[model samples]
Target chain A: MHILIIGAAGMVGRKLTAKLLTTGHLGGTPIQRMDLVDVIPPHEPQSEIDIHCEAADLSTPHTAPALIARRPDVIFHLAAIVSGEAEADFDKGYRINLDGTRALFEAIRHTQSYCPRVVFASSIAVVGAPLPYPIPDDFHCTPLTSYGTQKAICELLLADYTRRGILDGVGLRLPTICIRPGAPNKAASGFFSGILREPLVGKDAVLPVPDTIRHWHASPRSAVGFMLHAASMDTAAIGPRRNLSMPGVSATVAEQIEALRRIAGDTAVKLIRRVPDPAITAMCEGWAPGFEASRARALGFRAESDFTQIIKAHIEDELEGVQ
Target chain B: MHILIIGAAGMVGRKLTAKLLTTGHLGGTPIQRMDLVDVIPPHEPQSEIDIHCEAADLSTPHTAPALIARRPDVIFHLAAIVSGEAEADFDKGYRINLDGTRALFEAIRHTQSYCPRVVFASSIAVVGAPLPYPIPDDFHCTPLTSYGTQKAICELLLADYTRRGILDGVGLRLPTICIRPGAPNKAASGFFSGILREPLVGKDAVLPVPDTIRHWHASPRSAVGFMLHAASMDTAAIGPRRNLSMPGVSATVAEQIEALRRIAGDTAVKLIRRVPDPAITAMCEGWAPGFEASRARALGFRAESDFTQIIKAHIEDELEGVQ
Candidate 1:
């Protein structure tokens, strides 16, 4: 199988790449070659199969078509500007998130007879405020943020393009990656992971919101799983609604800390400092707390059931069980 | 106040223009100038206010920017390829509907200081089948047709642009327009109007679907009312959900014929011939039967309460009370 990964330098993309390499197969077929593209040059993974990596900005005219010209059998589109950056820079957000995605889809359509399996990285941000707890699968996407709006529009395009037989596409609306394996970033969602990931490593991490603030989450491991499953699953089952809200664990900040405490002891929990920021707090209020992702679950996608599993997965994957 | 009407040659656009001329004011301000554009040149309405009409395709590059250069206070954007045409011609549909709308919004954004009230003509086609009767406002748009997909995408853009403060946009998801005046065209929706219109005027009209098939509808007069109301209504009242499912009458084909019988006699009803075309039947199956347009209703937008009123309004508006 010839595979292509866009935004392959990103965290989940890298994880997915590692997983694919370890398996050496996709959808029961042996890997023959792989292609990767991102704004920053992706590291060329050590694999027996022919592999190529290139740096490309998809929003630029002709970039997407050039990437698609290789015509890989499977394409994983994981490129996007993060929510914080997207919200701060409107032009850049729409350009990369919306225009770039549309350009890729258009390029795929231009190939005429070639219809590859396309897996898109959508986000939970697509669902906005005044949401019912455990948001149903059919809930309308009324995103409160620019990033969410861009992702929602792409989801629409994905479904439309798939319906038109232009390409076989599946969009996975990934929940916030819990216990994210990196230094805390400026993303508002960073706190969700920082409080847990930082504490385990004996680093003090600021809690930006109250312990009562609940949000949906999945580990980076689960995110990779969601993408691989989406890449291979029977899309005929999904029909015209090509997007699915991937299953995830719903937890409050308190629950997340408790999960960390259970795994890493009270000393770790002590490292979490409470210093509320009203801007982040207000923004979190409009985010989805939970979801009834019955459709995705029924379609055979799985995730960590609780925060403890998410934290444990992070330790095994990121910390190499050092803690 | 300066006014711009895109697709001014369309049925609803022309009616809106006529209505505006008669009223001579909008949003409690005296009319100043009116600028109209369409693929076909709009008729320069006889009015005391300055009026200019031009033939232009909004999808073309530089067209929208040139139109926005005048900086109209209110813009009524009603341009689009209808359902059947859009379905048959995918590239044209995206070009005219999606790209055109985006270009116009981009033009407005480029103006920097100007934020006009933009009333967009969306459609109930945004919603697809396996739907709930009296479709709720919160229902997720999963359009089954290309036209619906285009309109839904534009609605997302409208909301996003409005939120960014580039324009004050109100998108009305108009139900299928009943009793459309003038010649019967090849539009899939043409039969809905033809069955009522041609028969009332003592001409035989083919019924493409069974009488049991129900659909949502509003009069052309009501559609015009919706545009005017959307233009003048308080945008602040709508919050972030910029689009609304407009109020309309929901009736089965049998119910529609009965209303016609009541208004124009049994002779008018007899003129309807049952010629069930499978293509139309399949198309109508995916359409919404009704809508719980409580949002628009609460906003003081009104429509005919029943099919009888719809028929009467058509007669008074189109037939000049002769019927």
Candidate 2:
């Protein structure tokens, strides 16, 4: 079966591509061909299967229809402007995130003959301030930021398009990924990973918020698992509410530090400097600490039970278990 | 203050126009001018204020910016394709409901000088099936219908635009309006008003579902009141959650009929005819039976307390108190 991966140049997309290459199959169907797309041409992965890589902006009018013409069996839509960038550039956010996503859906609808399983990467940022601890699946999306609003709008469109039989779609409101394996990115939630990732690698990291600041997280490996499951799951079980909040380990900054101390000793913990930036702190305040994720969990999606497991995944996958 | 109503020909828009004309002022500012826009030119209200009536489709290019060029102090965006029509005509729903609203917002943002209070008429359809009784203000919007999806998308945009300081926006999720003072339209929820309205006016009304089927409702008078309150309220008190579920009476079909019995006795009630329609009954089951509306009420937007009051409102306003 042919498969398509949008945003294939990003961290999750690259990892997912690697995972698919290793598995050699998805939903028990032998992978015969794959198409990967992004704003910049994604590095071609070494796979026996036919892999086509294209650098195209889906926001442009003809790009989406051109991509859909390939008719991949499963489409993983993981592309997005990160939280900080979207919040900073208003028109860019709407153009890339909202209108771009709608264009893709419309393209699929025009296909008229095929209904592909489309898995969308939504975000916990969709929920705004004054959050309840372990927020329920049904909590309203009052996005505090432009990026979150775009994600929320896409979720609505995803559900609607799926309901209309234009495409079989599922949306995963992924928690903030922990131990993100990369250099520091310009995301406000970067500290959630930087404090841990930097310390383990013998580098000092800044803690922008208080140690009491808690958040939900899952490993990069788990996120790939979510996409695969969403692609294969019996959608009838999901009913009309196609979007689900994936389960994740909820941990405070102090708890994250403690986990680091247990694994990499006090020297690693000492690398975390308590230098508060009020701007980051204020943005962190609106983010959720945890989620019920009852619907997602009930549907059989799983994640690391704790931050320690998350760190372990990064060590094994990114660090080659040399820590 | 100059005022603009986008859907001036509709019931709530007409009522709000008349209400503004009656008051002669809004937020203690004298009414200097009014612009009424719709698909067809709205009938000129008998008022001394300078009125500009335009028949324009907001979805078309240049229409929204043209409207914004008028520089109304407050803009009531009450235009939308109702549920049944949106479900049947997918393209029309997205073009008119989603794109049109965004165009108006973009026009305002481009102006960059003025920020007008934008009051949007959203619907309870934003909340989908398997609902909890008295759904809270923050319940996630999983719209089951295309109309609902479009409304939910607009609500997200409304909040985002407000946050970016493009416009001072407030979205009201109105309940099924009871005792509508016009001919039956194609709305799936039309029967909610039809059953009460036709029977009271000494005409036979069809009941599509069993009396046990309950739904949320507000009278036309109450709906007008909510818009007025939203136009005048200090948005700071609303915080970041711009979309609110307006307060209304929660009653079963039996309760509505009983209220009619109380107001106009058995004669009015006897005009009601029970004709089970499985299609409508199936549709009604997915609708919200009630809402908590705690936030809207706290912000001083009031509605009729019970179905009895709703019936009285229709009689006093539509029937000239003769019923």
lDDT of 2 by residue, A205-262 (tens): 9898999998999999999999999998899999989999999999999899998998
- What DockQ results do all the predictions give, each relative to the true complex? 0.78, 0.94
How much is the lDDT of residue B31 in candidate 1? 84
Question: Across residues B146-227, which tens digit of lDDT does each residue of candidate 1 receive?
Answer: 8998999899989989998989999999988988999988877688989899988899998999999999999998999999
RMSD (CA, Å), each prediction: 1.1, 1.1
Clashing pairs in 2: none
Leading candidate by DockQ: 2
Distance (Å) between predicted and true CA of A115, model 2? 0.4
TM-score of each: 0.98, 0.99
Model 1 lDDT per residue over A249-290, tens place: 999999998888899999999999999899999988888999
